[model samples]
Target: MHIPRWAIPAAVVAASGMLLTGCGKVPPGQQANVGVGAPQAVPDPARQDPSAAPSQSAAPTVLRVAEAARLGKVVTDAEGRTLYRFDKDTARPPASTCLDSCANTWPPVTAPKGRIQVDGVDRNLIGKTKRPDGLWQVTLGGWPLYRYAEDDGPGDVKGQGVGGSWFAAAPDGKKAGGEQQEQDDGDGNGGGRNRWAGWTVVKVRQHPRLGMIVTDGEGRVMYRFDGDRPRVSNCDGQCAKTWPIVKFTNWKKLKTEGVERSRIGFIERKDGSCQLTINGRPMYYFAGDRRPGDANGQGARNAWWVVSPRGEKITG
Candidate 1:
């Protein structure tokens, strides 16, 4: 992820807690560009090089709705850069998962002091979530807001569709993208595409990092929880939230590529939702996986692992 060059002057760093501290302007100096997965040392504001170039002025602390070419109406920071929400993050209670190195790549949009201003969006839907770092990250409709580091300037939506989990946030805090494309219903007979096509069809895709692995219609890699049993799922409540079950209906009409049809099936979840299965083990989608081809969920918690077209776990 690219580092952001936007400045916030006199921005006060409050102590660690989940409370909205008074928002302040950002201080001067470059918001350090760090390598992904490695922590880069940031300069202490107290000590600085006098000859260092000054940082740019801070954009007004306003959240606005802008029309994006691909995603239509999207929430943007005062700078007009596309704001995003992570699927791994929750909204009902409001939380964030993009932390540390992730934070460096996708900086949280800090909450403004006092009431927030908006344009072409419902201000009542705006709220805030206290980050682990004590900063109150702004939330629209309970979804935390963020700015992509790769977006060099306003109107850049490089962060859209990243990791398949990050998306340009809609004004109401939903995923913002153009009208859904028609899906290829597995059988030759063409009916309207299933609204859940992303989780409906299975395929064998060549992931740049994970090699040949099983994926859903949207090309997101699939995984099986080791703790689960045949035709059963132990993931529920919070666990279910993190690893959303592969939901599908009309198993008979399911599509596949490189996957064994005989090995495919479905298990009824406690909530009565149908979860797609391979060789009896339940399938799931990891919240951490932001986009297609991402295998970030592999080996998670020594339990979750990617699946292969053969319905076998991909280990090693």
Candidate 2:
């Protein structure tokens, strides 16, 4: 699961000629509750046009499976959203469609067989599924996986649903945390949430502390608890030290694409300044996690797990 820092460029170049498959992802959780950023450039919608049909061929007859632990472990981007990539095709869904030309654009994150290990997560939960062209692909709860070509780095998720409804599979096949879900809807349109297979829906709460996002290994979108909603740091500031929420200066700085703008509200604290709290819980970072590929804060204090608006928790 660890991609060496120096070799990325070479691997990307070599990936063009090779066939690197992907694995479905998952996020780990303990008990319940939590919440979960960003606008870069609008990549060409054409490169992702699914109507074009995949120029790539189907996968080979056999594929590979990975340990569930590796898939469950995660790394979030600076925006606080988890980063997922296509395990196979850059655009195709369920099966990997990236053949020769497309493979170069996106490379699957793979380690030597048996080289990666994740603690606490069940190994049996991780395995592979067969793609139509015979390629043995990594699957999370049976769903196929892939990575995005548009993603230039390990954490960049620009390729998610690039070609339309097909999205990058999370380690659990769903997403982690509620607020984190915003990152998944690249255009900020709330509709992409429909793709989740196991995620629950929020009822009535304007912004639940826990928001739903994708968690591939579990086969649906899910939510994980970030912390008790607050501004003074009820997490003992231990949580605050880890999962810091992004502060936007103006409403214009904050763009809720698909989510209703009204659903997007700000909270002002006694401190006079403001901290963003959805459903009351303040967001933060663990610093325990370093890279976008590192997910050190899955379930802290043991009581935390990602949940959806309806309060459904995602656990592995």
Query: For model 2, what is the error of residue 5's alpha carbon versus the real structure, in angstroms, after optimal superposition?
Result: 46
The TM-score of predicted model 2 comes to 0.28
lDDT winner: 1
Write model 1 residue lDDT over 123-201, tens digit each, in one string: 8888888875556788887778888989998888999988766889888777898533222222212235444433367
TM for every model, in the order presented, reads: 0.42, 0.28
In model 2, which runs have C-alpha deviations exceeding 4 angstroms?
A: 1-233, 236-239, 258-260, 307-313
RMSD of 2: 20.5
Q: Which lDDT values do the candidates have, in the order given?
A: 0.66, 0.34
lDDT, residue 202, model 1: 73
Q: Model 1: how far is 48 from its true place, Å?
A: 22
Clashes of each: 12, 72
Residue 256's lDDT within candidate 2 is 25
Cα deviation of 264 in candidate 1 (Å)?
A: 27
